[model samples]
Target: MKKALPATHTSMMRYAVLSISLIITTGPAVSSALPLMAKNFPNISLAMIDMIATVQQFTIMIFLLISGSIAKKIGIKPTISIGLIITGVAGIFPVFSQSFVAIFISRLLLGVGIGLFNSLAITVIDLLFTGNDKAQMLGNRSAMEQLGVCILNLVVGLLLLINWHMAFLIYALAFPIMIFFWRYVPEPRVNKESKETHQKINMPVVWLALLLFFLVMCSTAIIVQIPNIIVRGSLGSATTASLIISLNTLAGMAMGFLFGRIYKVVSDMTLPIGTFLMAMGAILIGMGGNLYIVSLGTILCGFSYPLAGTYAFNLLSKIAPQGSETLGNSVLLIGCNLGSFISPIGVRILAKISGNAFIGMFIVLLVVTGGILVFQWASKHVSKMKKV
Candidate 1:
């Protein structure tokens, strides 16, 4: 029996849906424990140890390709439940296993778990809500993901003080979230025959995916230079890096709450606003002479991230072909993940031209972003003129 698709789901049900976002970024919560992990495994190279933190991204991309297909077979709720289970089991797997390979494999599964549900997280919002409420929920979802990053990172930090193994316990939090989702959220009634007809990729999704790819590629490259700027300028200590990053996450969380209102006012122009702010953020960090300036820049970057990211998801909700929602989102997720992966190389390549790591990347991004902002504003102006 299928539950009726209502215009609105209950508040608790919405939160149950939102709870899953809390674990999306938890893959990196253990990053702070890397030094301790290195001490535990003397034979492992520092670079490999670092992979324990980032190896998730690679596997995320792999699982993203098939995430939709699995959801199709098992249904969304069960698919998400399985992903959460994988995350919980894999997350704590390191606590018991001493072998580096085993821990590394666990990290890989963490990515798999997140990848499986990443698209469905937003798909659920699309199905359960309508119009402004939908937009607001999407924003809340973004906020929730950042909130998870902020809280779990802190929890992991505190846990690290007791035992390096304790850091993995943070992933155990997923089981409760899984239980909440299973209990409160109803399985969306989907038309398998109709949805199955259009499994092929659509052009709109590809274009949006490209837009997100370029956006993330430039933004990530610019953000990556901030720590280097801090270190090179000798404006702050190593701890300052963590503080600035935290502020960045907090800024994104703040934006997620306000995004729905802001979107009502700006509509599609949110992309331009986001890109413009991102460019400004890079400029401030690259050129600013001190710590406070860099902090402001980092905050700007954070604020802009959810603005662009949520907007991408929102647009996809409306434009994604009915049956292939997860696949469309998977493409967008892959774009951003790829952007993060390529950012370092992009920064290194750009830095050579200007002889300053941050500035070189900032210059290109500023021009590109500025040009697009102008084009977008002009197009809107012309459209208004036509209406008048």
Candidate 2:
């Protein structure tokens, strides 16, 4: 007759810890692998190159609905465990890959893994916490993700100096994350009536979710492409690009910590302010030539992410039935994938018109800024309505 551990206890700790590992295991490796992957799979058409980045997001987007359902039906722990195993297996692929197809397929599998983990992790958090506790957990998850980017990107950059293959070694870090789930993380309590009572996702929530997805896509676009754009545009080498990217990570890490501190005072309005900061960052990155300006943009954008994510999570909690954050994550992952999928084509279009990829990236930033503002408005209006 042992009582269940409170959601505030085990579940929150589990998500915060896993969130760090998820980002560490995935984010930097993807960034580090890009240049090396291009070299290894030469003759990869731009279209195909775009697919490599986009495929993961696409798979996550497609599989998320199913993954969410599966998590509800089976268990969050199993879904998370399966995702880690898939990502781990996919990680070992680079060692064997010499062809475009091998790399391409591997990235898709990685997406499947990401989709599972992303969907389940959010759901687990949603199930475990309520009210402000939920908000803080989401905030911490955001911080952990930024931490992952900071630590992994820096490590990958240093490792890249050794050999590009060494970059893939980052995946090995995830092996321990699986063990962590088994040891400390307990199964998220499932709501028995949720399946029977939950309506089809509300229409308003769907629209907001889609818009949120687009914002995430924009963020991912910046994260995946910005470093290469800088290296190619101004810095002129992978090593230098790594330094610039590391600065971006440092900025994000600092902002993540700041958000963890300020989340209370900033409260819900953090979304608009965050979007404003992100817009400023994008403008600086797009328009400025001074490396310092670019660094400033990176920090501003980094801070914006957690702010936006926390705001979105709060909005989502209101719209979704019980355990909606998992669904919310699926939406977010899809947006990220769509952004990755769209970037190459967008670049192609920009390249044709402007004759340079960096300028194209700048243009993309402008477009993303417009989209971010639109969502900020929508989210705020939605929040006001909820209050009324």
Candidate 3:
């Protein structure tokens, strides 16, 4: 029989695996550099230039539904390693080529790399830890992911001052992360019984995934509309809007770090609480006239968005049958990606109908989130009554 690693070693390995979150930074890191890229490729339409950032999202969505199945056959460690390598290579390919077509293709492939292993960060936590440990690890993973995004965005912005190509080097961070993963993370052991148990999907997982989809949809609208909201409200300029958005990211990082402790106190009510916070934030942003109030609203939404997402993932991990954490995560991933993609369009349609985009999104969020919270409360109350 093989000897088990020390608890300390196991914990270190878990953190190392969480570093895979860096792969998600690739797309967002380039977002700040898009104007520079447009100047470089003046011949390309602005829409096409924007596609360079968004094309990755489409590929990520396509692969998220299947990456879990692929991991089942190849094993998680290898799957994640391959993903990092693919992302690193694709991310750098744009540096060597100035062709719009070439860079677009490279970004699309980078999405594939991210899609391959994004959910594994969560799945690995489910595999390695249990109970509060598992919950804490999940929270840590979210925090690490937001931290990666924050750092990469800052790095890319600074690098863009030197040369647009230099910003692409941020993807190189994946190489060291891959090394850490291979050296510290061990393969999970899955028995035949556990494998069989995870193969069948649960109805609750489907419902939760849909809930996540709607939540993400509403949450993302806050990001998409912030600039417009600020300019229209005369709360700030474009620079001020960006700064507020960065603050929102910081708020998310902080909330993710605190999620484990918060979850302990709120237990199953975490999701409802998150929804309520988001609704309050949306209302503030919709109605506020001052910068401070809007910034506070942004922070609240940012905090609640990731908190709800973390709670959903933790719940899914518990309900997942053994080896099926990846599959369950993938389902949730689909919901999240679909919601993100639809948010801008959904908000636009609602705004058209309401004749005020900002207020329209706020109304949508309040109604939807309020309804979900009520449903959750009623469900819990009924369950308790039945137990009595």
The prediction achieving the highest TM-score against the true structure is 3
TM-score of model number 2 = 0.76
Candidate 3's C-alpha runs over 4 A off are 1-11, 196-200, 320-323, 353-388
Instruction: Tell me the spans in candidate 2 whose CA falls farther than 4 Å from its real position.
Output: 1-21, 24-54, 96-103, 154-166, 220-241, 286-289, 322-325, 344-388
**TM-scores of all candidate predictions against the true structure:** 0.91, 0.76, 0.91
Residue-level lDDT for 57 in candidate 1:
93
Location of the lowest summed lDDT over 10 successive residues in candidate 3 = 192-201
lDDT for position 284 in model 2: 77
Q: Is candidate 1 or candidate 2 better by lDDT?
A: 1
Q: Which 10 successive residues of model 2 have the least lDDT summed? A: 20-29
lDDT of 3 at 239: 93
- The sequence of per-residue lDDT tens digits that candidate 3 reaches over residues 1-388 is 9999775347668778778875674586687778888999999999999888778988887777778777778888898899899999998887788898999999999999999988877777777777877787788788887899888888888888898877888888888999999888887666677655646568888988888897788777888788887888787899999999988888988998898899999887788788778877887787778888888988999999888889999999667665677778988988988888899887778678987655675676567667767877898999999999
Q: Candidate 3's error at 170, in angstroms?
A: 0.8
Would you list the clashing residue pairs of candidate 3?
Answer: none
Instruction: In model 1, state the lDDT of residue 9.
Output: 67
Candidate 1 wrong stretches, greater than 4 Å: 1-7, 366-388
Candidates in descending lDDT order = 1, 3, 2
> Candidate 2 at 278: error in angstroms?
1.7
